[model samples]
Target: MKYLAVLILLVTACKSPTNKKMEPKTYLDIHNEAIVIDTHNDILMKTEDQGVIFDQDLTGQTHSDLERWKTGGLDVQIFSVYCDGNTKNSYAIANRQMDSLDAVVARNPDKIVKVANSKALLKAVEAHKIAAMFGVEGGHMIEGDLNKLEALYNRGARYLSLTHNAAPDWATSAADETTNPDLEEKGLTDFGIQVIKKMNALGMMIDVSHSGEQTFWDVIKLTNKPIIASHSSVYNLASSQRNLKDDQIKAIAKNGGVIMVNFHPNFIDNSFKAKAQAFFERHATEGDSLVKSGMDTWYMQDYLYKKYADEANQIRPPLATLINHIDYIVKLVGIDYVGLGSDFDGINITPQQLDDVTDYPLITKALVERGYSEADIIKILGTNFLRVLDANEIK
Candidate 1:
């Protein structure tokens, strides 16, 4: 009985602490050390609409406000000057967004610096300031004018997404152009090729996130510099047109381009698409009414998004699904060709776990848990993007 008691005590003492999980330390520590950069964010729209200054601590959104970005250890952010595709005067709207960003930077010059080249970006980083860069969100914002595109670059726009939702007469969109028989595949006209050439010359990264298949290939053929798909996901995973196909991924890799993954739920999760479609179907008539009333696409999307937020919550996937997109791209094109492009204020809904820029550490943690090496994590976090920026900068 004495021996049995001694054996029991030994067993109890040696028992594993199943309830007390070990904290993941190495990856988290490595994440904090890296200079994290997000290639795309749209929080400027909030600053424009609600008179919410990005310099202040904003409460409701899961994006970059001055304090939040600092706490998140975000080194650089490329704010998207996004205007709806359907706008007849998109250039004006783009100008307004750029003005708004300029105002924000002017108001908080100590916290952020507008960077137009790799040198400025590095200087801002060394100064411990958040390097602010611009990426015009749609090609339409240039008004089909190459001069306007050059002017945007001069104004510090680093990249330009080709088109938004609807296909221009010159290029097809990934969204509706493929299915609609009436839609023509204009690919890139001579003017579009010229646009690419000018962008290459101006050192603006040619973006192909929303462009159709033909346009993507056309840009790939025309540009000598490394291109970027600023906010896209893997079509092979979600089977959504908004995501890049395997062949497209290969092409981007061949051109030494990077595909930045978007955080929108529908783009990452197939299940969310059905729910979003149902919500849109229910509001179809109202949406059409708003369109007929000449309501701006931004307002229209905001209205519908507010209406469907509750339903969307039921179907939104976990944020890990977004990381899966990164994993998919890395598998296809190697780790050097992928990065983050969280479309923060541009999209109405994000994945469940990612609430704001502060939640970026979670992505780092997830990548580590997925068996990514520390060196690989650093590359995915921002190093790869910085290399691309250095490679493609005109100066």
Candidate 2:
């Protein structure tokens, strides 16, 4: 009996814990070891406008700084130079934002390197430096001039997302399709197609994140290289116009492109739209007043957002929902064509539990828990994006 009791104790000791085996290293350890890349981040604007310093540690916000990104194990980050479409001086705004990013890289030469190609990205990683890349967030920033596109590209812009809320006359936004019948036939104008081809020739990535469905299809038909939806989620999950529909997801994969999931609350939760609508309604009159006063919608949005942030949290979706979108895209497109484009600093509210760039490891941990093989997870984290970058690099 004594020997049997001793044997039972030994068996119990040998049994694994109830939880699956996970290393004691914090999520950062896992995240750092991987070549983690976030395809979209709006921290450049935050750093420039809000005086946030990328080289310093961030205390309150979820957006990234160089130190935080390094701590989170982020190897590459494409800083989005986002200017609201309403700005008359969109090109100037874009330039200023780019300059801001340049300044950050200059200040932190030891920590970050501005990279334009796969070789630079790889070199930066080998040197343990953060690869800093640029992406223009809206096509409108080019102000209808293809020359401006070349100039932006020359100035280190690596990708251009085709349009924001206001679609060009030849394209219908997903938001306006329900009310605008004229947009039905308008996908890409001859000029738009020319612009896409120009991008292909220049080796600048064509980002279809905020484009109308017709525009998306048109670009797919025109571009010879892989494209990306820099910061979008699955429409089936959130029912947002900003999210990709099932057909769009499949099409992106078929084109040898990638879809980087967005972490905005409205993009992750279907039910949050009503709350957003109500929030906008309550501030509608004030918003119009601010617009009349010559304040851009982005400024007015920040103002009104502060008033509603607390209430907004009550309806914010869980971070798990963002993962669900990632999972959906992976299942539909396979693991090789998905990545993350967390719209940090650009978004007013994020999903719960994802407060900022520092929270990236949570995703790595979650992906592991979801039965993703480490190899597959690494691809989703950044390799897929690097592959597209390599394929699209201009000679």
Candidate 3:
């Protein structure tokens, strides 16, 4: 009887509630456990244009580096392959950017790997390596050729924004559609519809971040698969042409798509552009000189931002403003449709607290303070984008 009582006590102790796995009690704990994915980053462009070494510690010079990505807990990154509309040999330039990414992965074999589908993405994440993917930022890179589009997909490009700030022959951009009154075409042309169908067929996600209102609607109507706004903010929050309107947000949600919020200050703060116009105007001559000296205008702008850090920092919005954009989307469509897509290395400035990739943990902390549960925070960090990626995969 004494031995039987002792054995029963031992069994009860082994099955105690304390033996269960503990929940993540703090922000870092929660953040480290989640599969954080940033759907849009332009570091490959930076590497190709500036000849900057991405594997080194690029603090203060660039927003991202290979080591810093791991430090920030970023598990997946869709590196943007981009060239402005006017560049000659745009498709070749896009391939050159892809080559740069390939070299990056080649050098850091253990730390990162290129992924073309959801299966490989999850595998890389599980192995504690960053799953790098390609996102062609302009359809103009395809140059109105479907073969070129297929070639990009074959090279591991998973998403392609229909336009940049400038319109392609097949699709109109928000910047041109809104500002170019004399422009004859306002949306996707017949060829643009064909592009959408081809992307759907190839399992490549169609991105509408830079697309005009008409182009966005055309894609929403035509695509049988879910789409992604790779890097854009809320139109109601900031009123930027680059941001998505309320109806667009609703449409995306209804279509089971995801709008990964952009981190550009101008896209997050309503009055940011007006406030920064004078500063940019002051630097316009220097900018033009840099352009004449053969530097691209986008790089020239980023250079100015780096040069006038103190002055530029003055116009950046608070971190809460960015969180407000996320909260707005969550309130409108619930937590399943929104995620992070920091246009790091693409934008010149971020919100005040979000200085670089390392600051991602701050977002998780902010979400926690705002009463978000762990599951919802995980969704916002990466699962929502993962869901869209999976849904768009070729069966």
What are the lDDT scores of the predictions, listed in order?
0.78, 0.80, 0.89
| Tens-digit per-residue lDDT, 130-199, candidate 1 | 8888899888889888888988888888998887777555566776556667764457877778888888
lDDT: the better of candidates 1 and 2: 2
Which runs of model 3 end up more than 4 angstroms from their true locations? Answer: 1-24, 281-295
Candidate 2, residues 223-247: lDDT per residue as tens digits?
8999999999998888887789999
Q: Count of backbone clashes for each model?
A: 2, 1, 0
Better of 1 and 3 by TM-score: 3
Q: Best candidate, lDDT-wise?
A: 3
Model 1 scores a TM of 0.85
Q: What lDDT score is found at residue 85 in candidate 2?
A: 67
lDDT of 3 by residue, 1-395 (tens): 24323432343233223415675468887787777999999988887778888889999989999999999888899999998888889999999999988988999999999998877777777677899899999999999899999999999999999999976889999998899989986888899999999999999999999999999999999999999999999999889997999999999999999999999988999888887788879998998899999987777888888899899888999899999999999999999999999999998888998899999999999999999998899889988898888888875
Return the candidate ranking by TM-score, descending. 3, 2, 1
